[model samples]
Target: MPGSTDEPTEPTPGKPSAADRAARVAAMRRTERARARRRRALVVAIPTVVVLGAAATVTAVLVNRPEPPSLDAVTTYEYAGGDHVSETVTYAENPPVGGQHDPVWLNCGVYDAPVRNENAVHSMEHGAVWITYRPDLPAEQVEELESAVAGETYTVLSPYPDLPSPVVLSAWNNQLAVESAADPRIDAFLAKFVQGAQTPEPGALCSNGVGTPTG
Candidate 1:
């Protein structure tokens, strides 16, 4: 053994030292902590962005909205006739004139009501009298109605002039007849206008006695 040329032998196992293993574990823990921090930041940031966006949308909606008009400002009238029929006409806050039709004209009562049939029945029998006398209508347009219903005319029961603004008119026979107009009137013979009817109650006819029946 003293004369052998080989070097003294050492252990040949292939495991890491204590310091190298500890360093590797520390690096893995640091990477895990970094990933957790990223996840938490994403959760908080996404909701914050969504909430801010929703608030901005609601603000835009409120700022761009328009105010609505008041219904209480309109003037209304009630007219009566046979068969327990009655009609109500509502005038626009700003009534147009001279045979012009305004969108504000609408029938607010039942068709069987005395006043409901005034304009609807007469206009059908005669012509577009409501369109002829609207406050917004020009004199030329009113004349046009005369031409349209030249030979065939019906009675206008309301005292108000045919003009642009809603008005209620009526005719009566076996069934009550009523018509509505933003503006218009009918032309017919006096006797023929009331051929088969009785007169309506005085105050129950026009608005504050301002309109007179023409049939």
Candidate 2:
């Protein structure tokens, strides 16, 4: 039996070897981990891409939007107020543009009642725009004016019982009189002169002023 020449053969495999199985298991785990990493990357990347794209779109829209045209036809005056006088000062303009005015400025807001001219003049000195309309103006027109001035800082609105024009917009040393509330120049005037260059005190405070609304 020892002399028999047949080489001892390796065991015939019935199943995969332990080492092979272990290698396959490890490979599968590695593949699953790679897939999970890709998924996480995609989750993070997708939202970031969406947000960046949205921001870019908004920026483009803002950049492409048209700017308001400059208004040059507005009436100009030279009423720079360097003095704060307590006495009533008569101004050339019905609602004075700028002059010796009360120390306190009227708070900027819409008013159904008339605001005192003296206090409003002080607001103008502090770079406010005063919008005065005739008391007899239509309610609808008044509402239009109110919407225009609402939420705008350094702006005031009140009925001016008697006005040379139906509507008057006054800033420091500048005034614009419009015949109707629907006038297109109303917006132009405000855009040009609300806290505009003509203000004697360019950045003065318009809030916490002395006047209140009187209906």
Candidate 3:
């Protein structure tokens, strides 16, 4: 043993053993697997969170939306349309819901004077809501009706001679007579009947027709 060049074997410092390298590789693998699990969790969770947020938003909209008003008092009529006549046609209704209409539809807007019955009826055929009030109504009340139809293309506001009520909203065959300008039914009528289902000719041009409008 003394003559041999090889002496007692000694472990080298700053060198990893086979077991240590295997342990380090196993640890790294475990850490990588943990990271992969976390990434998968986030991938699954993000869409779930988005879906929950979207569902919550839809629920809030449904809950906060205003309920439709009751249209129990609205008077429905069965009037014939598309009857173009040249002469002044006498209608059974005071404001003339729908009957013989002029060939030209009156341009829809705010009118300070009494619009012709024949022309206005033609407008009604074209899905225009005619809001007529008595000529003698207070200026402020007249303003209220005008404001309701302001910037509206499908509405006609004018004065009618000897109207039965202070305010009368006529849409084709549908008519609603409200006593006061502040009546909620005025809005209700417009909501339900502006280019509504009962329209004889929906999407008809309310503009580019006859009569000069104040607005």
Candidate 4:
């Protein structure tokens, strides 16, 4: 018994065999690979989210900004009358070429007497007004026109019996001209008319053209 070695002992209960240990090591390696893949995905996802957020912020800043001012205000006029006597006048600032410009013209004169003496005057007289600034007109001109003509009355001419009368209102540097068969209260009509006359830019009432600024 002293010379004989103890019989080689069997592995303790539940202790893994060499092949089982190899399989456990392979399973651990697979778990680690899965964890590493998840880590790589998170890294890519974070940067992609950051880039999209930055792009959205930049787009909002560029698209919602205000535009710069590049246009000025211009003045307009209106005239009205009947068979008796027609007259014209200005509500705000008058243009330099009131009756002698390309777009502004005065067709005021007396016509031949009618066959019936009662309606014999057959007169045609009308007034005209407008505002103009050289291409370099100052911005203050707009304010000046508005202050000068805020509540003034101007003659409106309706040349023919079948034609409607014209209503005029001064707003900013522009004039609103409306034609109707009846007369409108000055204050009420002006409130609506001015809205159309006042534009943020300098140009014609209906179309864009050269003109002075109204405040």
Give me the displacement of residue 120 in model 1, in angstroms: 8.6
Over the stretch 1-215, how does candidate 3's per-residue lDDT look in tens digits? 77889878765564444344334434443434444466432222122235654653212221122333466777878988888999999889988999898999999998889989999999999888899999999987886676666556788999989888888889988888889876756666776677766788887899888889988
lDDT tens readout by residue for model 2, 16-128: 33344334434443434444466432222122235654653212221122223344655777765777878887767787787778877788877888887888988888778
TM value for model 3: 0.70
Model 1: lDDT of residue 187: 22
From the highest TM-score down, the ranking of the candidates is: 3, 2, 1, 4
lDDT by residue (6-80, candidate 1, tens digit) is 997653344333243334334433433444466332222122234655643212221121212222222233322
Each candidate structure's TM-score, on Cα atoms with residue i matched to residue i, is 0.20, 0.65, 0.70, 0.17
lDDT scores of the candidates, listed in order: 0.28, 0.70, 0.76, 0.27
Clashing pairs in 3: none
Error of 1 at 173 (Å): 16
For candidate 2, which ten residues in a row score worst on lDDT? 57-66
Pick by lDDT: which candidate is best? Answer: 3
> Which regions of candidate 4 are displaced past 4 Å?
1-125, 155-215
**lDDT of each residue in 151-179, candidate 4, tens digit only:** 32221121222111232333333343333
Order of candidate numbers by lDDT, starting with the best: 3, 2, 1, 4
Every candidate's CA RMSD? 37.5, 30.4, 30.6, 37.8
